[model samples]
Target: MHAGFTLVEVAVVAGILGLLALTMTSAFEGMEQARQQNTAQAHAEAARQALRTFMLRNKRLPCPDNSTYGDRGREANGAGSCPGDLRVGWLPYESLGLQVPVRSQRLRYGVHRGTNADLVAPLHGAVDGPDLEGTGGLARALATAAQAAPSTDQPHYSGAVPALSSDTCASAEPVNPAFVLAAPATDRDVDGAIHPGFDGPNRGFATSSPCVAPPARPATRIYDDVVVAESATTLLGWLSTATR
Candidate 1:
């Protein structure tokens, strides 16, 4: 007859297996977060280029989309409002004639309407209430997604929050936002529960002062608002250089 292994041996093997599984799981989570971060940054970069392209060709930024999801989220006319609260909102992605269903598409965007003196006055000409049309838009174009569960709130993605303002912490602070993007570092609705960090009550609104430099990791109360600060003056500068 063959002798079987002792109970301790079995327990030890089980422990080893559990540890290995945990290690693998952790690794996967890190990889996913990193991918999301890169994708968010990519979206921001693309938007910056898109805004510049639109300005170069049309001499003005396209208005933000004001309609709801049903209408493709674009302004009916040149009269859309991104609300005073957000200081930003869904950009007129369609009007800009950009490709839809972008790889890891940006969920939403915010732009200063030339209100914050610090962000706009520096530009030397950009004005306030530069409101554009925008309604919260697609996680990806023409689709509804369920996050965490079948009946849970669908989570949105993250992007670059470029601003021109001096104080990032104060909300209700307006600026001449020139189409900046922002993303949630975490699930906006965590398993059907609302969550902060990366995505919070102020999804695109970063209430951190001095536009605190974005962290390499995800968003937190302290360093959650990752933004990119650009101004009309900067655009004008770019224009001048391009024309030269």
Candidate 2:
């Protein structure tokens, strides 16, 4: 009558098996996440190495300006421009012989400058005066010329300035010569708030704003890695390894 086992015993065994299955599922999820993280880290390191090699061969860093070669020149401050005599711009990792799959978004280098709203001068008083009136005339012509001229603070690689989102790091400026290595924030959310920075890995920009509040929350992922020619390179990240 009891050759197999009691109903109660069978039920208990089934429960134990279910618990084990649940535990195994959780373990597997953790392993998968770990693997993804390791892969991402390895890819990032490879990109860095490739960049180093490119610099070594060309004696300059690649500048990403949407394929435009406008910013190549020498500034009074000693900053190098894009498409310099060296002719290096947007060095593709594939060209460098890297096997990793290149992310389209990651492939882009340099900051994206938004439209020049400020360049258009606002209408002022005395519109009818000879000094200010006349479309297509000398007065109007001068105004248009002034607007078209490059900003005195424009960067050499891309005369355009970086778009200033509300989430930009408190310390970030329009033209930062040291942007690559500086801890200035560089990312914003859909709402234009800056993400929190990682505290551990110690990579990426540091925030000058308070840690609390809506837009001040830290970032959750790594961002673009910007390198300036013959200068320090800055890595933008969301969370620090330590904090993670």
Candidate 3:
């Protein structure tokens, strides 16, 4: 008869198999995360291009899709004369004719809300006058003035993936950004709830700054929010090029 394997050999084999399984699970998780990151970046770029196309055709920026005031995926009345306070909200996919796979992946949008150069309102009248630059001029001026602006230091936690403390402050603000697009990251804590600071200052109209840092931690905050910004100069340049 063939000799049977000892209990020690069986235990050793079982442990080795368990370790291999664990390693494979980790590798798969990492690959999925990379895929998600790439998809989010592509979606953000698409949204940016769509905004440019919309502006080139309409001569005005669309207001964000404010679910509180109207239906989802559509721009609010603000596009015509968006209230000065209504500056940041969900991307108006319907207004821009932009599409994405699901609502969860929709970008958060923020337009330049300077009183001197409100960008969300219709610019038809401005373009009708002798000086073809109306809101465009104001935006240009803001962009120029912001060239030497100082960075904003806000109180927040430390670390890149998870905050270890709460007494630190960094130059965390984007000065005079003409527009910003942000995509929320996956739940790093895996607690089924998104941490408040994960998206940094890109949360809401009140909390959303012109821009924010990514993968930053702010006091136990799990963060990896992807963000993109367009300067007024760049936008006006594009508009000029597109119209010419």
Clashes of each: 34, 15, 1
Query: Model 3, range 132-173, lDDT digits (tens) per residue?
Result: 544455444434433534333211111234233322223444
Error of 3 at 118 (Å): 1.7
C-alpha lDDT (0 to 100) for residue 219 of candidate 3 = 20
TM-score winner: 3
Q: What tens-digit string does per-residue lDDT give for candidate 1 at 95-139?
A: 666654431243354443332221111222222333222111211
lDDT (tens digit, per residue) of candidate 2 on 53-123 = 54334323344322322122221123233332222123244444555232221322222111221111212
- Candidate 2 global TM-score: 0.36
* Cα lDDT, model 3, residue 133: 44
lDDT of 2 at 232: 24
1 against 3, candidate with superior TM-score? 3
TM-score result, candidate 1: 0.58
State each model's CA lDDT, in order: 0.41, 0.31, 0.57
Error of 1 at 32 (Å): 1.6
TM-score of each: 0.58, 0.36, 0.72
